[model samples]
Target: MKQRNGSIQQSKLKQAEKLLQRYEMDTWLILTREGSDPSMPLLIGVRSVHQAAIFIRQDGQHLALTSVSDKGNYEGTGLFSKVVVYEDSMEEVFQELFQELSPAKLALNFSASDHLCDGLTQGLFLWLEDVIGAESLSSLEISSEKMLKELRSLKTEQEIERIQQAVDLTTDIYDAVFSQMACGMTEIEIGQLFVEEMKKRDVCNGLGNPYDPPLVCAVRNGLAHRKPSHYQTRPGDIVIIDFSLKYQDYVSDIARTCYMLKPGEEAPPEDIQRAFDTAIEAITQSIYELVPGKKGFEVDQVGRKVIEAAGYPTIRHSVGHQVGRATHDGGTILGPQRIPPRPEVEGVIQPGEVYAVEPTVIQDDGLPCILVEENVLVTNDAPIILSKRQTELVTIKKNQVI
Candidate 1:
């Protein structure tokens, strides 16, 4: 465990060094209390209590000011060169330290667009003002969005391995589901089967709502971001299953849409087929355009254009999103249009980042909706599809064997 923590710190430090050099930052400051910051587990490998601040200089110097109780976990990794601890109040000690290493620019973990970076709460920010003093706080910069996005979205080699394991598990679970699915099953019934199978297979459960997995949205009943219900699934109904499992702390979030065919049917209806093809093409085009240096909107445009060109109503949501620790892992967005305060949706996609391309076109011919979401890893040349890409609309026929 100690070695694993050390390795993660080393990897983050290496990346931080490069980011500092590229941006000419003076120091990166991360403030958190009670594990409010998402970077806490990744940086220190433990939940934190009491207020704490981690300072990383552009020259690779790491310093931490934390409560005595939390000092050991942060110090155990040997990642912090200097560890300052206090029993009661941190104001006196913290002010002195701030005076000594007065950074010209300080990166705070707050963003208007990304929630992962926006971990610092308003109440805590006010308390920190007293801890560091008004003068020192004035020197800070709200430029941590770019830094956090680059660090969080970009995966290391080991992280990719863990993610791949989760992805494969999800694919296997898909097989389990398709094998057992039949016509006349309720959405909740299928969901129950999924829960049982995941337990039997011992797959890790996802966060939020606790009892339920991610979601299993059936045709005409639910769309993107909606949960499943007791709605009965019928023959020729478009069924979309969206679920994920956790391997260690990594997550695999993949979704697939298929047609529930009647007896002796091999393929879905014509309209459904065309919609699936358009979504797949959009995904392919988006992947091909996802090389480094391209803006987020540019990659999203590839999918958006393909769908709109094919005469389908444009999807209101973005083309895709970054997937990692969380399903919508924040910052690195792959979307053409976004509402205000998320203006940074046009940021460039960097190599080593992972994303989920989900583009959906509704099938209005009394058929189900068509949405295909696949995972991808951004590379220098072409983005690599991470999960097993769906090539066709799966025909779930009666009495079909796996």
Candidate 2:
């Protein structure tokens, strides 16, 4: 485990170094005031320093600047190589460092298009401008969004392992729910059951709130991304579950639909079954074209075409997105419009990238919507589905249901 953790850190460091080299940047400055509140939320790892400012140079050097009160906390992390403790003037400290390094170009976290790149607040930006002066501030440039995208897009072996573990645990929860789903249970009840199971297994919701879990189960309103309400499951009702388990800071998103059976009914309505099958086909077809080199929009088109051909209206949302530390992480997304339009995204898909393929189909009546979501990892050959795909609709008998 220790070796694996070390390997992941090394991989991240190597990627950071390569990004610096690619951009021809002299230094990458990540200034943060608090530890848990990192420069960017996605970069906040276990080794992150709190109540300190961190600086990473192009030469793979780390320097942490913090006050005496928070110096001990940053030092305890043992992540930074050089820990510089300051007593009351960050401006003076930064000036001295600026004079010494005097990098031709300093890359700061600021981008108009990318949310991750825009981590630096407006107030912080003004402060930085004041300290660095107008000339030096103008010389400072924004870090390429591609650098941030690539750094987060490529998952290390440990990250993959943790995500896989989360997938497996979620699968178990699905199985357990499948075995007990029955008519008369409210959507909230079943959603709570999933949370209970995840808690039992020591998994947490990525939202970081212990009291509230990240479980969204909607009956008949699957098309709407709303929370589960007090509506109880009735015969012929479709209950859709959209959930994920956060394990070791990694997340797994999975969605499945369950059908409530009437007292004498043995199978779901043919139309319901057809909708479910069409959703599955859309999801499977989307995965087929999820290779590295293809444009993200192209992959989305594959699924949209499948659904449209099946006589269903196009899904309102994107086919899928890249998943990592946060539920929605990274720049390259498998959606209708690929952001940036860079050739690198068109570059062949490499191993170690994980994504979630979610395809939804709504009935003409605007009633229940069938949604199938599964996490997948892009390999050299083809994408591997991490979460178990819903092969058939889960049926819950009236009396036998939870």
Best by lDDT: 1
- Those runs of model 1 whose alpha carbons end farther than 4 Å from true positions after fitting are 206-211, 338-342, 363-366, 399-402
For all candidates, the clash counts are: 0, 5
RMSD of each: 2.3, 2.9
Residues 144-207, candidate 2: write the lDDT tens digits. Answer: 5667777777888778888999888988988877776667878777777777877788777655
Which candidate wins on TM-score? Answer: 1
- Candidate 1, residues 1-402, lDDT tens digits: the string is 458646865897778878987888878888788889997666566577888888888887889999999998788878878999978988788788888988888887887767887878887788778777767687676567777777888889877777787788888888788888887778887777777777776666555643475577676675656566878877778888887777666777788887888666667778778888988888888888888888888878888899899998886888888877777887668776556535556787888888888877865445547777888888887678889988877777655522
Off by over 4 Å in 2: 1-7, 35-51, 211-222, 338-350, 363-368
- Which RMSD does model 1 reach against the true structure? 2.3
